[model samples]
Target: MGTERDKGAEQGTVHYSGTEGGWGSVRGIVETALRERPKPAALDALRRQNKPGGFMCVSCAWTKPKHPHTFEFCENGAKATLWELTSRRCTPEFFAEHTVTELKGWKDYDLEQTGRLTHPMRYDHATDKYVPCSWNEAFDAIGRELKAIDPKSAIFYSSGRASLETSYMYALFARLYGHNNLPDSSNMCHETTSVALKDVTGSPVGTCILSDFDLCDAIFFFGQNPGTNSPRLLHPLQEAVKRGCKIVTFNPIREKGLEVFKNPQSPKEMLTPAATPISCLYLQVKTGGDIAAITGMMKHVFAKEAERWAAEKIHVLDVDFIEQHTDGFDALKAHVDGTSWEQIEQESGLVRADIEAAADVYIEAKRSIAMYGMGLTQHVHGSDNIKQLVNLFLLKGNIGRDGAGISPVRGHSNVQGQRTVGISEKPELVPLDRLAEQYGFEPPRDEGRTTVHVCEGIQSGEVKAFIGLGGNFLRAIPEQERMEAAWTTLRLTVQIATKLNRSHLINGQVAYLLPCLGRSEEDMQVTGAQAVTMEDSLSCIHGSIGRATPASPDLKSEPAIVAGLAKATLPPNPKVRWDDWVADYGLVRDAIEETYPEQFHDFNKRVFTPGGFYRGNSARERVWKTKSGKADFTLPKKLNSWGTEDKDGRWRLMTLRSNDQFNTTIYGYSDRLRGIEGTRDVLLMNPDDIAAAGLKQGQIVGLASDADDGMDRQVGGLTVTPFLLPRGCIGGYYPEMNPLVPLSWHDEESKTPAGKSVPVRIVV
Candidate 1:
């Protein structure tokens, strides 16, 4: 195995390691945006992106500062904007030219490139094509099918892209329709974050805000690559580095963004080419080793506290805070003391010395923030991974203080907000008492199916109808082929989207694609141009107004579509005025306030304020709402690195999105950050592993899982690329490798698939 140069790779697709975010990021922003949009149109969208009175970027959930500079959007943000605002249109005539069967043959990127949907379409089985239909006709058919099926047999699925207002309406519609089968994109991504955070800290959302970056003396990262996922975060990390903050990172792969970053917006940096070095200490943890690594850090911190206590008669642990704000410290301390350095080194792939060094930085810092992404949450023991992080932070009294807290770096623009406004399968999260009091209908109190369960329900013929409120549901979930077949089992499948995607192509017996307005497009109703609100990763709920022309006159807002469906399906009720809610979104906000008055008090008025308002966290106030009325340090009982020992040299595969991709949406073939271009069909692996397997670089290989799920579960024709990864670990692009993931493998509590850790062997 050798490097890209040694392998004599293709001209443009060569892979290499380099510093992240400089002129290259700027170039990528321009080139990607210009592909889908004209220069003027791209500039207009870019100018409006993340600006006050303008729409937020639909890319990542990274928050904007109270005061933002011009050109606040990043490269991926521009791509998402351009992808949505593209001038191309998928007219009814275009659908006439290509049948649903023909469109199914198109690649995901190619299908999105066909551009925005121009009209409501219903699949015509005779022609195997989707034809134009009126919004009423589409809604009426969906209502008829929904009425026919058992309400519990219908799944109301949401994508993270939907605004808080839209999500609230969708949730209400589902509850009012007499079903609680509400599953969203959060199920696949940060469901573990919600489950774990709430259990440990008594709150689900991130405790810290963007301002914490400035005040924190140390930032510890676990399994996150901000360079490609959330480039805007690099600026704050860069500033933190400049402030002499110790940024330590633990990830299986050595990401370039965590190594160093040069903000393109900084004129001084652009002029002098000075890039701030990020991640003062980077630890290469093994796949699925987050819990072990976190445990190691806590173990080291405990040992240090023991030494300090003996030497200076001073307590390193915050005994006062622990007594006041926490519980189960003694048990956690005992567990840490029992856990040996040998076990930590074996599971974490980090020696005791490195773990101690990291613990030293944390021990030295007065205040530190732990930041993580999907890497920590996409494991079988992901919930435990979070609990361990909380244990580490709470050990030093990190909760409820400035510059110190747990920050789960979210992906989609409003996933956290979606949950905030009540899009959950969990009945307790929904304000049912408030809903009954405000809307005059009793909601289903029983817990509902998540994404994984929804798939199982569909496959078992229990769920007959599925409605996706703005996401590529079929592609985002595991077992793509299985999901496609399961979708066919459904009686009705509805997709509320702006563009055609794989989900739309995979037809149920009766399928309808309802074209909706993109976030950046003007949403004109009887109240005139409307402004929507979304909550970012930092819990900042801000207003977003679209000024651009809608891609098509037929396009409706997501709220409008939800309202239309609700009105058509549910009987007229005095309290639930669907038409009034659609005519003006403020009415929706009023309803939201009524449902979640504690969080959304004065919601309509407060959302319009500059920089919006924060949905203040209980954990931030140190007011724990857990059963014990305090933060709890739960000990992880089961600890397995990779969730598999890999005795026979089985590689642990983790699925990741390319730099050019956002969620399930593919922008291009290039992952500029990793220096991989032209194709996404290559696997990044450790050179030693490749050599041991007798596989040369650039050689095609077939992947097969070790799971006995009785599924064939194989994806072939992947070129092996030698890269800097820990031993026994490998990486592949997601959706492509999703088939190799067994549906049975998921976090038991959260019900999230372990897409990041799969025990797989090379097929020779």
Candidate 2:
């Protein structure tokens, strides 16, 4: 059994191995597989993961290689697979044994560990438990409730796990039902990237492909840990390092993944302790300090260019690209010039010399890739952070090239694809006219609610229904306690999922838990076995066909479930053939192709070929699709000044995930890389901060948000563990630290919860 801990007490010790992914990773995979019942099936599914004609790993959105290895899957991918293909079943009998009230007290990990949901179940008010219900009964009841409520009051939330087809169908169904409240997982994480990238580059997606890693002279990582999050990516990074490419990292904590990696696939490496060094230089930037850090780098570049020009008339800036392909260079240069070194040093928590050193690396490199994750987003100035990175890249002309570009390392498998296929809250983002013309219904033009808006809507009783297309929605969002209570106010809640989660237990007046096929499970439709396609972080669309048997014969495919809900709810539209699309899925692809002719012209045929087809990015061709028709060098009004000071003894806290966890899914309690074992409630603090707070290591403490929002937000029993973090900057696992972030505490432009930087005071 996994080590158990008290809810609010420290149950683990601090031990940093300074390495990631070697024998430890292999052990983790083996242990995970051993724990999962029906081991043969789990092991078989693992081998097929990420292979051509195999299911996509339902973990991160990292792209796969064209010529794959025997074990293309990572440790987390294996855990995710075993997690989905587990023999443990949450049958009707299991639900009958546990009441909603009782299940509410269980840990989120325990809830999921109950395993794959086998049957459709509805909340029984009298028993406070979910009772088995026929598919027809559940659908009819949901349809009636949906019909009763105003379409605007209903929120359709799509998790990143949903395929392009399922998401496309989901968005279509929601719009056909008369509303555009299609908030998704992206709203909370990369909405800032979407909002910022679109303004800078015509496209919101990353321009670099998987192969770009090989050609780049340098790769800069900001706020993302590839080892735990996207381990498969480490392989390329490993190869890149071997080929003498520089890896630079800027993050609060020195992530083990970015430090060193041992390829588990390599027999020699597995037998030996030799590991590839990932980051050549690591900058421990303060929380919310990325903007200042980036600005400092840009300033250094400009300063160097001036010095070089004065000495030998040598040009450092990409003069041709900047003058012809980009706008706002002069304004950005002036902004950087006006910014003082003292301000940069103070805000970024780094010496000017160190910043210059990092900048020197960028200036010297022939080509570089600036890759960032939620760390750059999830801030009050999140959009500005992304904009500044783009500006930095633009100065050197890193984008629109073979070896360099801006790559936002996305988390979810198809989060980017969902946005591409119109799973957006912004009606302007989606091709509404085409959708209307194709679906034969006038699509809603009114702006829809984002995830934060949905939370507010639920609080105000404005949102009456929520239909989740796969995700632990309630558990993943901020203001968890408040949201949980607000969730009860909903008239209807429908979750189409493969397994039981905390969200399902947060019952409403009329709630239905609809079981859906996992990515590893076979989806047999009328046309035969169905294959769904997912778009990776690099915008490569590929096919995923489940090779394992269905966990439960009754489980429906996500597309089929969406079709059922659409058929039961909407008035029949002759143009939208829900039955036919769900039957073949090829019909759905054909519609997608028709909807996005330029991107998915031959989606079905091309997606199955080799490593899948690239959804060509216009920005990569230097054809700026922005209003200015040129890449814009945006200037932030000021550097991020939020959560910098140690005012009122409050520390800047950034919520992060453990190696054992993905999004809100807790695979296990061990974060082997961080040396965290058996607990997720520990707070990682600098030794100086620990001493300054008059708190000793292993001391239990509570955290209270310093947000101006009237509500008192606090979580307790977090054990203080000292680490090498910037003073006044601490880190804690996400979802646990989510409560300290108010719903309103989000990016001004993207409204992505500023989960990366929350000011909180330690409560002893």
Candidate 3:
């Protein structure tokens, strides 16, 4: 079934040509720029973005090009920039006019749309409104509340918006405060990639760089949509297609970005009807069927190799690389041979022929790159799903080479950098010994709470205090209803932010909204106008210097705010100069170099390099740091990532992002690529499934989770709309669909919420 292009579409939905970018994207950028900033300011921000001596785009982790364009920013990047540099302000007067309780009733979009925060506000329980407070006063009050509770009881959460310097200081503060509870945004999104890749490839980050796309013969996309998540990636995909590179996409929905891309930057393409076709082949895999489908592909590769070897003395598989650089081939082969075709087909929701067709493309390509997003990582067997893809790459020695490696498209600008600089719940992941030596304090070695653990802590009352370093933490996680209720029980809640979000309204006993400078705003310090660094998905680190004026003169940089908190909370440690580091960010980078000498050698100098320097991956160089001292071929415990069977008429529901949205932040009600507009409260389902469930198109329905967790998780007022999807599979926007995902329904190892596959039943 397809979206109807009739009068009914005007009510909520519309059908457009399944093409991304071109005039539509240009219109989006223009509308956003005009809405958020003055003409000159918007034009200036766009030109300076992703350029040398300019701020990095706060949208996605896509790397900047070596030879920069006139405008390096994408549609979403422009929206993010304009949104940050918006003239609208959420000032003390605005807060005084609206009570916290009243503001909680506002929509997510409306709350953020109120605009950038302009003051340090403290929640006044007596008046039920946030009142302006001095920075010193806010810090003193927060420090007192923190001292009253066990340090372990406080959760220090971070978002990817923070730069490397800010993240480093935050981590130091948390470690010195006697806990490792540094749960950041990565815990929710790409934790699976870290856990899975580390086990097999020794590195937690992707091995490929931006230049790899130029040499790759084939590109395989698994459950990732570049149109919304990372639009800058479309340029490389478009370029690769023009160079005769084959692109294969395996997703539940045929993403428009992967189908065809009309470069908005290219005047020739924009003026003409010509558009670059992206994906050579697109396979609609089931919501939770990545593992089964990937396994089926591997099965085909092995069969082809065996047939080739028997017919002619030819070896299709890279036997030499497998023997020298990898292990567990025999076990992987045994498992593949043992699995039946029927089982693969049933779990994958795709016939063997289609699976083989995709595998054939993989087999033919001499050099290939495997890339994926949250769709493959946010599942019960998310790690296993990733490992299966690694196994496929290993079969043909696709990794550790030019134009061939695994790439996990990170969502946020510096999420990878945050983790690299020690924003993690895992104690061993960070350089604790070096941090201790550098700061002259003993660091905690205990494992800390993840995002999921933080939720449990909140619910159980163990987490008394919560500190967020830029994000709507309460609204972003699963079990929205439970979180909103449990949030009120906290003694202290501090949100260091650039804008007013829903999380700011969910007041604790004592809540403080600390306004900080955004990426677009100049972060003036004691030294001079400061520059911070961010690492992209390609592991390239570069400097970002804000050029726009600060939204509020009272606002401080994130590093300054973090240092202020540290000074207020902890006693003076002469070895650790918090004020000096905040005064000059170069000192922070120097400390980072000292902590991780190998990775950040000459950190201050190297980060400022033209296109930035790559923090080299050991796996990419074929030097495995795993316990086995080589790349390992691992098998998943189950073919089906979801624990439950496809019985009782339950449908597998996956949460997605609209083209107009980024993470939990909504830009608008429209999703132009998917032909969705005017609403975020609709469910996209296969027509066959809709008919079977006795549901008509555009019918309003409620969805209740089939999780056995005893929680009656449900989301109502959803309009069911027909779309192209596998049988028994459905799609909906994130955070809205987050209610259907149980807090406990997560990946077994990573504890990342399986937001992609929630078993649900329609309620009339």
Candidate 4:
């Protein structure tokens, strides 16, 4: 693979910048699949679309009802759903032909290359094939092995894609299994935000919901590029601007999607392929410098208030809300006052004038909201960064008020809901206590490991078995190469998924692939079918029913699968009847309501409508729950904190997904936003770095992390494409370069590995 031409570049293989083929390849896959398909299932409202629904969108986590829009979904969301509905199946016959060693050589796309899982299967190591097995045999085998291992030696990983009902049941099953070694997808991304925000404000959810977005006069978005990640937000953004909301975005790279989005609802905009400009102010902030930028903005606000106070100006600061609602203001004020302009500028990569300008816009508005995403939280100091955002919002009396708050736009539909419905690796006392009271059994009390902690436990042999529900665990884990190693050591691994993925191959000594129904697929339960509850970004709990029929008669719903495993694993408890819950998921919801009366009213009665009720806080505008009895201002540790091993200017890095990907699934290889086509081999770099490295646009170069592990060979030749990014920073496609990220570099507080902030050197 040694095709590089540069003296400094010795890595093998310069991948082509383009896809080689085109959308024609995508069209071919669809056409070929349709031809081989037994039946075609068209999209429609879920069985409980207008009633209480229980499904989360397989797309981005922006929550809304399943309504017909001109733009049904984004390209990635469409791909996620299409892949779910694929008629092509990975049958036992196909697996019998390909050995694990041969399959190991296939690219991630090439393995999923087969199709969706059509039946439950177990790996036969002797034959090196995954042969079809009966549901009883598979579940019993998994249960027997899982029970043999002590619960502390087991780990449960979650994906953001799970529905609230499934997630709750998953949590219950795990708790009953006797350990809290629960790791979810959140640990990889927003775990720090959850930890930081809760410490400061006592809740892990974003302050602003959809209603707030509609009411806000101004919105400051940091580290979120909605165009590629949350395309559904583009609609709301377009609408907000139409109604005169000032939208500001703080991002390192100039994201084209945020800059321009074509709202199909608009007559003029929809007719053409061109996009409408969304973000009014685009601030080019530094990679790990968000805390500095937020602090700088607050300092400007403080200065403005000070000037107003000296002149005896009225209503300059929201002093009424500050005095009555929050604590720790004096400390925060002193920190801002003591911070030198030089430190702020050096750390933030933005000058005082620039920060002041953004502050001026914020201060001018009567009601303002600042929303963020994973872009701000994928650092060693990711939690500190989030607290600073909360500090800013609390400064202005944003929380417990209309049209103002701190918002973290989540990725998957029910990631927030899963956490609420008891999916926490470290569940709080309230939910656990209530769960025990409702179910008449003690819920496990010990805190569990998050996604990163679980993997580390696996690698260290502290954990033996792993059960993943609905996530592409192997591909989703950052530094996935290490995750694969950790996974291989496990005695048992279980994946309940809708599609075939690489996780099936990266197996433990004993592994099982349980095919489950998708959100798009029907989940026929007793009492004339059923619905599930999902918590949205806004804390709105809604119900979803699968509109399409199950792909295979063999496929079971998650609850049913959970019941199957529960029966086999634990001794039969009369009070905790798995059969009753599986018999009617409504019974599960009824139990959930018993545990959480505040959030869930009558779980069955409320879900009968399409627009589900909002959870208590968001619905009732209650602030009774926070530690302060109101929102609190949490101070971040500091922004200038560099990762210990990454201080050598080897380029602070962030892993990004192209528009064609969602979670661990790759729909296509092309990243239309960064202008890379048909592949993820290209790197987005600053022009300054390109010239300093003696490289040019389209010039192929090798990228390697500076940190030394057992392997000094973590380099790859990627075609360079220059962008207007901050110096000492670079961006590249993920999973392809996930190897460069070290597992140890994750945030300890949140256990979220720094996927957005790996340090690497470029050689040409």
**Best-fitting candidate, scored by lDDT:** 3
Clashing pairs in 1: none
Evaluated at residue 643, the lDDT of candidate 1 is 55
The sequence of per-residue lDDT tens digits that candidate 4 reaches over residues 123-210 is: 8778888888999999889988988888888877778877777887788888888877767777777777778777777677776666
Return the TM-score for candidate 2, rounded to 2 decimals: 0.97
lDDT of 2: 0.87
Please write out the lDDT profile of model 1 over residues 1-107, one tens digit for every residue: 12244234323233545567788887877777667763355567678788777788888999877777688888888888888888889889999999888888888
Which has the higher lDDT value, candidate number 2 or candidate number 3? Answer: 3
Better of 1 and 4 by TM-score: 1
lDDT of 3 by residue, 1-764 (tens): 11243123324333456468999998887777666754356567778899877779999999987777788988899899888888889999998899988998988889888988999999999999999999999999998888888999999999998999999999999999999999989989999999999999999989999889999999999989998889889999998999989998888887888888999889899999988878877777888888899889989999999999999978879999999999999999999999999999998988899889889988989999999999899999899999999999999999999999999999999999999999998998988887877888899999999999999999999999999999888888999998999999999999999888888888799999999998877788899989999999999998998878788899989999999998999989999899899889999999899898898999988766777788899999999989899999998989978867778768899998998889988888878888888899998887767788888998999899998767798999999898877888888888889888889888888998999999898889
In the order shown, what is each candidate's alpha-carbon RMSD? 2.8, 3.9, 2.5, 5.5
> Which ranges in model 3 have alpha carbons more than 4 Å from their true place?
1-14
lDDT of each: 0.85, 0.87, 0.89, 0.73
Ranking by lDDT: 3, 2, 1, 4
For each candidate in turn, the TM-score is 0.97, 0.97, 0.98, 0.91
